[model samples]
Target: MEIREDDLTGQQIIALLREHLENMHEITPPGSVHALDLERLRSREITFWTAWEGDDLLGCGALKELDPTSGEIKSMRTPAAHRRRGIASKLLEHIIEVARQRGYTHLYLETGAFPAFAPARALYQRYGFEYRGPFGDYADDPNSTFMVKTLVG
Candidate 1:
């Protein structure tokens, strides 16, 4: 799979992001959801990427700078046809590598605590992320689980 930077304006990337927003809204309780909006993504706070297999948009994920030593994962999603094919894992690994190359020493993420988010939480755990208290603009919320992974590079 090809992993590359996304400008947030590409039709396929935009549609995939919209899908992520829709899914987050459907699965996460309204008051606890923290997915970024299009405008924020278009800004410099985030670095976004799309994963592709030839012309097929397999998945996408983003890393946002929360500070000099750490970042947050955002907008991770895999197309319906591509789920369970290791696309999200590949995208996530790419994001982690990118963060390390960019000098980030830690990566944090907030995902739903619901059953639908089980696979995602498990994936993060496999990558060595440990549960953590809320950071940045986040607070303790019953609907969200916060996690972090320290980078060795």
Candidate 2:
């Protein structure tokens, strides 16, 4: 599979992001769902990527610069059909490498606290991300689980 920067214009990517947003809304409470919409993901500080196998999209993820030394992972999603084939894992590893290349010394993310997020939490844990208190604009949120990984930059 190949992972590369995406401009978020293709219909497949748009649909994938829409599905991600929909799942966030479905599983997380209203106020605690922080998934970004298409426009929000286009922020100047964010770099989006899609994972593809030949012509098929396997997954997508993004890295949002929080500061010169820190970044946040966002929009990580593997389509239902692509689950458990290590697509998300590959995308995440790519994002982490990108962060390191950008001179980021730390990477962080926030995911749902529900059982629906168990797999994701496990994935992050396997990659060395440890549970952490909220950072950035986030406050104490019971529905959210924050994680951080110190990069070797």
Residue 57 lDDT in candidate 2: 91
The positional error of residue 125 in candidate 2, measured at the CA in angstroms, is 0.4
Lowest lDDT sum, 10 consecutive residues, model 1, at: 36-45
- The TM-scores of all predictions, comma-separated, are 0.95, 0.98
What is the C-alpha local distance difference test score of each model?
A: 0.89, 0.94
Looking at model 1, the pairs that clash are: none
lDDT of 2 by residue, 7-75 (tens): 999999999999999888988888999899999999999999999998899999999999999999999
Model 2 off-target regions past 4 Å?
A: none
Residue 139 CA displacement from its true place in model 2, Å: 1.0
Q: Cα RMSD (Å) per model? A: 1.2, 0.9
Residue 75 lDDT in candidate 2: 94
Candidate 1 lDDT tens digits, 38-79:
888877878988898898899988899998888999988898
